[model samples]
Target: MKNTLKISAITFIFSIGVLAQEIVDETLNTQVDANIPGVVAQKEIDNLDDQAKKLYYEFKDTVSEYEGLKRYDDQLEKIVFSQEDEIRDIIRQIDSLDNVNKEILPFLKETVDSLRKFVNLDMPFLKESRIARIDDLDSIILQSNVTTAEKFRKVFEAYQLEAALVIPLKHTRIYRA
Candidate 1:
């Protein structure tokens, strides 16, 4: 009888251990599933950051070219107005300048539009980061001088914070509740 009781007690403990493990496994699986959407959202946020960086660089190049062209235009205007022997040459040069500007104008306009979109997309990330208590938000702002990855890291951190908040709620509300 003593041996039987001891065996029974051991069996009970083993069963309880097995049950606890099963429960834990289930919880872990649920958490993983719940986190999937947040992970996907974070990826989307990263993609937006990449697009923004591309646009920012494109805009910077366009502005630099535009400034150089403006300087050239000023010089050309002076030349065109100052001399008569080269009047035909001046007119031809002006026409060439107009053609170049015309070609560049559309590209510059497109870059500006892309920059605007990037700014709009970036705002949500900034707001989320500020909400998430991320330090260096100011430093991470897309200045003309900063590296793209630094800006991306800031944006990524914001998404991580948002995911941290959202994943738990999603798990509880969808699976446990």
Candidate 2:
């Protein structure tokens, strides 16, 4: 009887220990199940924070680039305005030159006519050559290919040649011994 009672007590103790171990295991599983959603939520929050930081840096870089481009555009505008002013000044100079060119030809013709009259009235020194030079001037004036500046230069050169021929002859009385 004593041996049977001891065996029954031993079996009841072993069954209680197993029941306690099962209860502990069930509590731990429930706790792990309850915490899963919180862990998942923390991971999602960390990912979103990283993305926000990346987007903020990108925004900053974009803003910086826009400012730089705006400054460049303003500089270009100033340069364009300056170039437009220079173009207007050059146009005015060209217009004034056009007026001068229109008036010069008639004036040159009168001057050449006056020079021819003077040469004809002067002393007959170098007569044929001076006449030939005047004739050359007439032909140069009528030619289509010659520029007005060149024609004027030729006339000035002829006037210089005539001036060079005017030398004062020295008057000396011969004393007879």
Candidate 3:
């Protein structure tokens, strides 16, 4: 009887331990099931935070691009203003050239007339050819297609030739051979 009483006590204690373990396991499973929505909500919040950060960085980049474009626009405006000043200067120079052209032609024609008079009064050496050259210069001065600058060059060249002829005659003497 004593041995049976001890065996029954041991059996009662084992059964209570098993019942406590099952109760603990059931409570843990219930808590895990209830927390499922909270875990999913936390994951969604993290994903939204990541997307917000990405959009903020993109907005900053757009602002930086806008600033760069504004600087470029300012540089272009400066260049346009500078070009406007240059264009005005060019227009003034063109007007001045027109006045110079108008005044130089009459001066060149008078110079050719003076050269003819001087040659007529000078020595008889090569007189016919010199007269012919002066006539050619008169024709050149009257031509409408010739530029004033070209006419001036021709008249100056004729003076240089006459000077050369006079200088050589003064330096050397010619004898009949």
Residue pairs with colliding backbones in model 2 are: none
State TM-scores per candidate.
0.44, 0.61, 0.63
Tens digit of lDDT per residue, candidate 2, span 32-106? 998999899999999999999999999999999999999999999999999999999999988987787678777
Question: lDDT of all the models against the reference?
Answer: 0.67, 0.85, 0.90
Please state the error at residue 131 of candidate 2 in Å. 7.3
TM-score of 1: 0.44
Q: How many steric clashes between backbone atoms does each model show?
A: 0, 0, 0
User: lDDT value for candidate 3?
Assistant: 0.90
Candidate 3 residue 163 Cα shift, in angstroms, is: 2.7
Q: Who wins the lDDT comparison?
A: 3
RMSD of each: 46.4, 5.5, 4.7
Q: Which digits, one per residue and each the tens of the lDDT, describe model 1 over residues 81-158?
A: 777648878899989978875665454445444444444554353554343344344434525475444555655565
Model with the higher TM-score, candidate 2 or 3: 3
In model 3, the runs with Cα more than 4 Å from the true position are 1-44, 127-147, 172-177
